[model samples]
Target: RRSKDIRFAFDRVFNEDATQEQVFAGTTKHLITSVLNGYNTTVFAYGATGCGKTHTISGTPDDPGIIFLTMRELFERIQATEEEMSTDLSISYLEVYNESICDLLLEDGGRGRSLALREDQNGVVVAGLSEHHPKTVREVMQLLLLGNKNRAMSPTCANAVSSRSHAVLQVNVRRRPRTASISSNVTVATMSIIDLAGSERASVTKNTGGRLLEG
Candidate 1:
């Protein structure tokens, strides 16, 4: 066999020994500042099956991950500026499965209904998606847990309880001067955190029909 070389570049790279905190700091910490400054930000994890994407995005209670750390920092910054700025935080969770979008925050996890996407001045959005205003990090985490329970999951030969869809959590932030006049402008931004489904190979995963289609 002939040998070939390929080179790739990234903003940053992590080693296997990197802790969750280290990963978040290197990859996502700066986005918090952008969100606070009224700029949209997004962070997503992609990899092959059982590669720790889920763990990094949503770590266990004892070892909380990016979601928890980000929320905690966001709330802290907002609180620090509460005297001068009034801020509102709204969260929406959804899943993309089989090329269909479903609201994971709904009572029944939006079963039997495929949501439509529409474009507005703010860009693309999911119509009829529910948004919940969370006042504290704990509240935000509670919502995350609920959404996770509703997320699409299934067993696969590559890994049991594999996520079968892409999970997206959007945090919308609106802020305005606390003492601003009626004509004052408000700043709006969104921070989207996504846990993408792992890439699959049918030959290895042995997925069939729906699962294969999803992959």
Candidate 2:
């Protein structure tokens, strides 16, 4: 019998020893800074079930994750320039399930009202989605928690709390240089962070009934 070998290549790879700070420094820090400078950006995580998509995007509170870290930096930058710049920050979260779109930030008691996706000069946009402007990190985090509680999830043999839908969190930032000369000039940018549901094989997940349908 002969053994087959596999090989793969990527721009960069991190092992178990890679700290969350290190990962963010290498991957997300630039994007966060760019958003402040008026560049639209998006960061999305994709992988198979039981991989580390959620862990990397929304890790434990103590460990933090890309979302928390990026938001913190944004607030910090705003504060640093608050004396000379006026900044507006807002957030919106939503999920796509069963080929239908649902707004997570809606206070609709988890009834999962289907929203419509529209495309404009901004590419794709969700019509009638709730966008929250948070003054502090605590407020933004609270909104995130509320939205996450509405995400579609189910248990499977591959992993517990397996996501059944794709979730997106978008942060909108508008900055105005507050000088007496050009107080009306504003620069706007957006950052969309998405956490996609992992794909699962029926045989591997061994899901049944609703779980099977969800997977």
**Candidates' RMSD to native:** 1.3, 2.8
- Report lDDT (Cα) of residue 109, candidate 2: 22
Worst 10 residues of 2 by lDDT: 105-114
lDDT values, one for every candidate: 0.91, 0.84
Kindly list the per-residue Cα lDDT of model 1 for residues 67-106, writing each as its tens digit. Answer: 9989998999999999999999999999999989999988
Error of 1 at 20 (Å): 1.1
Q: What is the lDDT of residue 34 in candidate 1?
A: 93
Model 2, span 51-70: residue lDDT tens: 98988888778988889888
lDDT of 1 at 125: 91
Reference-based lDDT, residue 35, model 2: 94
Task: Report the C-alpha displacement of residue 164, candidate 2, in angstroms.
Answer: 1.3
